[model samples]
Target: MMMLNIDDSGMARPYLRENIVFNHAHTEISTGTTLFACQFDGGVVIGADSRTSSGTYVVNRVTDKLTPLAKGIFCCRSGSAADTQKVADIVRYQLDFHRMQMDRDPTVLEAAVACRSICYAYRDDLTVGLFVAGWDESLGGQIYSIPLGGMLLRQPAVTGGSGSTYIYGYFDREFRSGMTKEECAKFVSTGVALAINRDGSSGGCVRLAIISKDGVERRLIKGDCVPRFSIC
Candidate 1:
């Protein structure tokens, strides 16, 4: 149940990792990678390549990268598995609290704030990187990203990871705002193509999810993929 962690003063805190053992539902180990999220005029498009690394070598290839929170929001992670699930758990609990207290689903902004707060709870060692996408009618499909230990950040869109710089470069050149769902999907396809190509740790499959008012629209896995989406 213990993993290595150096505290602020370069002191080891075995308890931080040991405190939450895998025996209980409190922990789940995960390794992840480049996730794509785009919000368009109609809804949201989220794409995550199935690649994971334990160290420098590929460890998993057919991983599910995106998880829907509700009718309009989704979350993705690309870091330590234990930390990411803890962050997700925070989201689940907070949403429940808000739904009962405020009488509405937590807004994307509110969710971002909550997630980022979770990231900071680790201070420095257990930080999490998140890509959040959803429908903010006023913004009409929005993309926002948070860095490790980040606070409230409002971006039109974002990408994260050791390969983030490369993904962002692709996004800057390829991402199109105010797009329709079709255009957004196309844009996401292009982004995934770039990530899988440049990020050695990303590949095997892609789980694509689209979000709208009605609900989330999921795409076929690689084998069942239709034309371009399955090209990998």
Candidate 2:
């Protein structure tokens, strides 16, 4: 009689256990769409569409993706709503604790590293993408894109989610060096609006966060605020 052995591939030489059991893995597919940020002359402009979807279903129409992770830093969440919120809370808590302990605020890069550490720890289990935008005394203003596993990329302009494919061209054509804060804000708003128009997964009102040397400003760009025609 020949002996059969099963390897890592789960294949047997001939006969395997008829009762072999396969473990089931639970996957929760939740995501949001259309988040982008850009740097202007003196500040950074971050914007996102307020749409949350679970697989094919629209879970919420009014969701805020842009959140303040630290006193001067803002982040946009794009995947797994619950995971995003929970990660944001964790990052915020860590930032707060760091500030309290050091008696100083964390720079956007430092904050990114901190958040990335947390994301790295859960790289295998969590699905989350983030963009960190803020003003730094040393670095001026910047935006850092954080993908799964906490890989961080400093970008002058970036977009995440399915809608990113549609808006990158628009952003490339409209974005330029040394744009004013207002110009950056308009560009972000228009890019998000265009995403909502084309990407079925992206819709609802546009939210904006302007982080500058002075402070951070939040506003909602309503329908009328979006230009009827291209503003570029």
Candidate 3:
């Protein structure tokens, strides 16, 4: 039996379920998620494809990993199962708390703080890689990313495991200025295709969510042409 390495970013482990465990316990499988965010005049476009795998086993396919955090704020994650679940719970709690205390809706900045707090608390136990999108008050449309160390970035980003290369390239070319949300939707569809075709660790279903100044809307676009994410 052997113990594996663990860190704030992520860890590598070998299978030894009975006699030993990696990180904290059993291996959580090499899974990942990729989220693409674009800042447009009208709103933010977030397209995430569902593809979770464990070694040779396709654990979950066509899953919904992207969700709306606030009215116009959306989040997408691809990383440790532990971190994902934890962040989600914290965000939910924060939103609930804010509603109870202020009697007002939580904003994107607040949501980011909630997420960062979780990362700081269990900074040693989780690998939280996430992207946050919304209409920035000053910048109009804004896209931000928070990786392991709470580093925020805005660059038409990508987050996930092995299949990142394929998806990142696809996003870079298709993403540009003045593209409509609909066009970005198509671009995301293409990105999903590239990930499914090239990355073995991802691809079962696709979930797409878009957010605007008005609100957030999601749909599952799995058809002959592309995979769906949320709404059926």
Q: Whose TM-score is greatest here?
A: 2
Residue lDDT tens for model 1, 177-228:
6778888777776677566666666666667888777677887457225233
Which lDDT values do the candidates have, in the order given? 0.69, 0.84, 0.66
Name the runs in model 1 displaced over 4 angstroms. 1-32, 136-140, 221-232
Q: Which ten residues in a row have the lowest lDDT in candidate 3?
A: 18-27
> What value of lDDT does candidate 3 attain over all alpha carbons?
0.66
Candidate 2 lDDT over 1-232, as tens digits, reads 8577686888766555763443322335455589889998788999998887766567777788888988779989988888888999998999999999999988999888877887888989888999988998989898989898879889998889878888788977887888888888888898999988888888878999999989989989774565444456
Error of 1 at 35 (Å): 1.6
Candidate number with the higher TM-score (1 or 3): 3
For each candidate, C-alpha RMSD in Å?
9.1, 9.0, 8.3
Question: Model 2, residue 123: what's the lDDT?
Answer: 89
TM-score for each predicted model, relative to the true structure: 0.75, 0.83, 0.76
lDDT of 3 by residue, 1-232 (tens): 6667554467766445653433423457434755666666677777666766554555677667775676567777778665686687678777878878998777676777778777767777778777777664545566667777776656643544455676675566666788887887666656765676666666655666667766666767663556433323
Which residue ranges in model 2 land beyond 4 Å of their true spot? 1-29, 223-232
| Model 2, CA-based lDDT | 0.84
